[model samples]
Target chain A: AQSVTQLDSQVPVFEEAPVELRCNYSSSVSVYLFWYVQYPNQGLQLLLKYLSGSTLVKGINGFEAEFNKSQTSFHLRKPSVHISDTAEYFCAVSVSGTYKYIFGTGTRLKVLA
Target chain B: GAGVSQSPRYKVAKRGQDVALRCDPISGHVSLFWYQQALGQGPEFLTYFQNEAQLDKSGLPSDRFFAERPEGSVSTLKIQRTQQEDSAVYLCASSFLAGAGELFFGEGSRLTVL
Candidate 1:
């Protein structure tokens, strides 16, 4: 079985400050990791994905995530955040053959102005 | 128009009532998925379809929850005897690749069973 864990439920950060959202997964086999962002009353949008190589993956809105195999973590980061960056972030995991994706509970990022 | 589209943006139903939510995947997308998201929680898988073939439905919570993609492009999720616990945002997503590719999601249909 595969599962994703997002330790933070809510993270408040000031505008123009850096932010990081942590995500950890447990899987016996190799897995693909992804980060998704969902705005208020909107559908989830893919931020970045780690399929094979290049542990560091960049995504839209200046967001990036690094896949750490040893630690089983894929943490998302941003150099600086704006009020518009406030949204719910989700971490998902899936295997190569089985496309079933398991997602973390979520991390609500509140960017203060 | 370019992304996955879902119908009935919001649906409020009394307990035991039946409801149907529809999803129109992006044109040419071969894979479609359904997920249920509770308030302040991540989306949980409900079912999946490749074209018109329903491959996996292991995540469905109960027998009352049923989903079908008759023509391979449009899908409908029918809930029989809706319960209060069924209240959640039902999301529909589609992808061009057969396996796990980038998924395009719809705004989702918010269901509130009272």
Candidate 2:
């Protein structure tokens, strides 16, 4: 079984400030990790994913995440965040060649202007 | 449609009543998925379908929850004898196939069971 854990339940940052949302996972086999963002009343949109090579993966809207295999972590980060970045972020993990995706509770990012 | 479309964006049902939510996946999509999101929580996988065949339903919470993708394009999730705990947002997602590809999600159908 595969599981995802997002450490922070909420994070607040001023506009143009850097932000990082921590995520960790436990999987027996090789895994695929992803980050997704959800607006107030909209569905979730993919932020980025880590499949194979390149520990660092850049995503839409200037967000990025680094996959640390040894630490079992895939933390999402953004150098500078805007007010529009305020939303709910989720971390998910899926085993290779499997259709099941396990998601963490979620982290609410609030960018204050 | 350019994206996955879910119908009845909002539904309110009394306890013990049944409700059905619909989802229309993007054209040419081969895989469809259903998830349930409770308040302030991430979406939890409920079921999955490959074309018209239901391949995975291990995440379903109970037997009262039923989902079917009759024609491989459109899908329906039906909840019988709904309870207060069943209130949540039902989200539908689709992808070309289960791989490294990203999944496209619908706006979701919010169900409020009183």
User: Residues A1-113, candidate 2, lDDT per residue (tens digit)?
Assistant: 78899989999999999999999999878999999999998999999999999999999999999999999999999999999999999999988887888899999999998
lDDT by residue (tens digit), candidate 2, B2-73: 999998999999999999999999999999999999998889999999999999999899999999998889
Candidate 1 ranges beyond 4 A from true positions: none
Candidate 2, superposed: residue stretches over 4 Å from native: none
What's the iRMSD of model 2?
Answer: 1.0
For candidate 1, the docking band is medium
Q: After superposition, how far is residue A44 of candidate 2 from its true place, in Å?
A: 0.4
Docking class of 2: medium
TM-score of each: 0.98, 0.98
